[model samples]
Target: MKLLLIPDKFDGSLTSESFANAFVAGMKKSGVPFTSRYIKATDGGEGFLKVVGKYKPCISIEVISENPLRKPIRSYYLYNKEDNSAYIELAHASGLELLQYDELNPMLTTTYGTGIKINDAVEKGVKHIYIGLGTSATNDGGIGIANALGYIFLNDKGEVLPPIGSSLRLIKSIDDSHVSEKVKQVKFYTVHNVINPLFGKDGAAYVYAKYKGANDKVISDLNKGLIRLNKVVSDKYNVHYNDVPGAGAAGGAAFGLKSFLNAEFLGTIDFILKLSGLREILHKESFDYIITGEGKIDKQYLNSSLLQSVIGLGMEYGIPVIAICELLEISKEDLKEIGVFDVFDLKDEQKNLEYNMKDTAHLITAKTAEYFSDK
Candidate 1:
């Protein structure tokens, strides 16, 4: 039997590479005669630059950028000299991981730090800039980034507002007089795996703010701020950002880039699949089964469309696809109807989440071996 494995990180538990290794070990333990190949791929999230570096001849350009609270931190982006292209992962500058438990308030957070990285790349005369948007720590509608690129947000009194989530609702006007002329010449793309809208129940603020430490009132306020931002953006760009898909990505960073910088949106999975030469691989090889998974197989994962794409690939090749997630909350029937041949979860239900996470590698190995032992 031949298999191909492609998995995402199990959140805090295991990386995709480690997960694949453990699974392969399990297969070996089962004494199954199998040949397998694994890929370390990312959907333009944390490991995006690493994937880019694998495909492109690039160098890391380090720059001092700001954290979510406008504090200085060292960050870097992948710069390709051959095509003058740059790739940036947003979390490198303004991610939830950068904050302490007490510092997890989205109201005070800003994406200005990410903007600083973008500005650094822009200043280097890069013709193309691709930003991977995920795991952001703010809900400021990305005005913070605009601020860093010379766009100014002002209150009704014409006073400049600070670049924070709290400032989004108070803005009455935007100024681009001091914006760089070079900004208009560059091509920009916001890469993400979600298809959420700019502002509403499914939008950035309502769906993501709670994880960023927002209370109900704060979430509502942030949602209102996003609406206000959309209005302002629509007025200036003659584009209705709220109607756009994927505009809610990274706390409206996608919307901001499209509205402010004329950036296009690229789905993360498709972008990576093409760049990683997955199609080329498929043409040269055939696998009996394709194994793919993430940390959770819940509603969010259902909406992610990553698995769906993988399943589509399997269906195209008449190969069965199997999922091995940490927890599978969705109906097995639902997944099966959509081309998944099987689903296996790794959670040790007898134990608490802490133990399960701490020993995920073991659980994954045990489950894989047990499933194939009798086959």
Candidate 2:
């Protein structure tokens, strides 16, 4: 049998590449007569650049930037000299992974570092830029980026306001006279992993701020700020930020880029798949089974275009798709309805969190061996 192993990162434990390696090792140990191919699947989040860099010939450039807390750090991006294009993963500079558990407050975090990365690419005279927006640690609605690009946000007193989430509601006007001319010359594309809107109950602050360490009060404040910022964007740029799909991604970074940088949004998985030629590979190669999973498997995965597209491809090719996830919240019937042949949940009754973390790879390998050995 020929099997394709494609999985997303297991959050804090393993990367997609690592997960694929573990799965391959298990398949080898199973003693099953099978040839396996591996591919890293990402939703334009943390591992986007690593997966893209695997197939694309690009130069890595490191630059100085700040983290969510405005601390100086070194970050990098991939540049394709042949196409005069740059690929940026937002998480590299302004990601939640850069922070500790105690420092995870979105109200204080900023995307200024992301802007610094973009400015670095722009200064290098790149003609096109593609940015992956995921795994962010801020809820500033792109104010920090705008600030870095020379757009000054002011309060009612006409004094410059700090570019942070809490300052969104204090912006009385925006000054664009000092905005970078180089930024206008480049075409920007934002790869969005989610489809949330800019404001309202399902919007940026309401749905995502909690993950960034917002309390009930902070969430409420952030929501109000998002609403006010939407109006400001409409008045200043004549763009209705709330009308755009995926505007809430990365805590309104999508909205901020669209309104200020004239960015066009694209689905993360589709863009990555196209860039990696995965669809063409699927069409050309014949495989009996396709395996995929992530840190968690829930109804939310069903809403993801990434998972949906994979399922569609499997159904079209008549290949059975199996999932092995750290957590499984969907039922067998639901899984079948979504074209998943089976699911393997990693949480064992006998294992605790610490044990699971330490033995995730081994457990996955052993389980895969046992399951296919029976087959």
Which numbered prediction scores highest in TM-score against the true structure?
Answer: 1
> Model 2: per-residue lDDT, tens digit, 203-310?
888887898999999999998998888888799878886758789888999899999998998776567567878778878989989888777777755544356656
Number of backbone collisions per candidate, in order?
Answer: 0, 0
List lDDT for all candidates, in order: 0.86, 0.85
Residue 47 of model 1 has an lDDT of: 74
User: At residue 47, what lDDT does model 2 achieve?
Assistant: 76
**Candidate 2 lDDT (Cα, 0 to 1):** 0.85
- Model 2 steric clash pairs: none
Model 1 C-alpha lDDT per residue in residues 23-117, reported as the tens digit of each score? 99999999989999887667556777887888788999999999998888999999989889999998888788899978998889999999999
Worst 10 residues of 1 by lDDT: 300-309
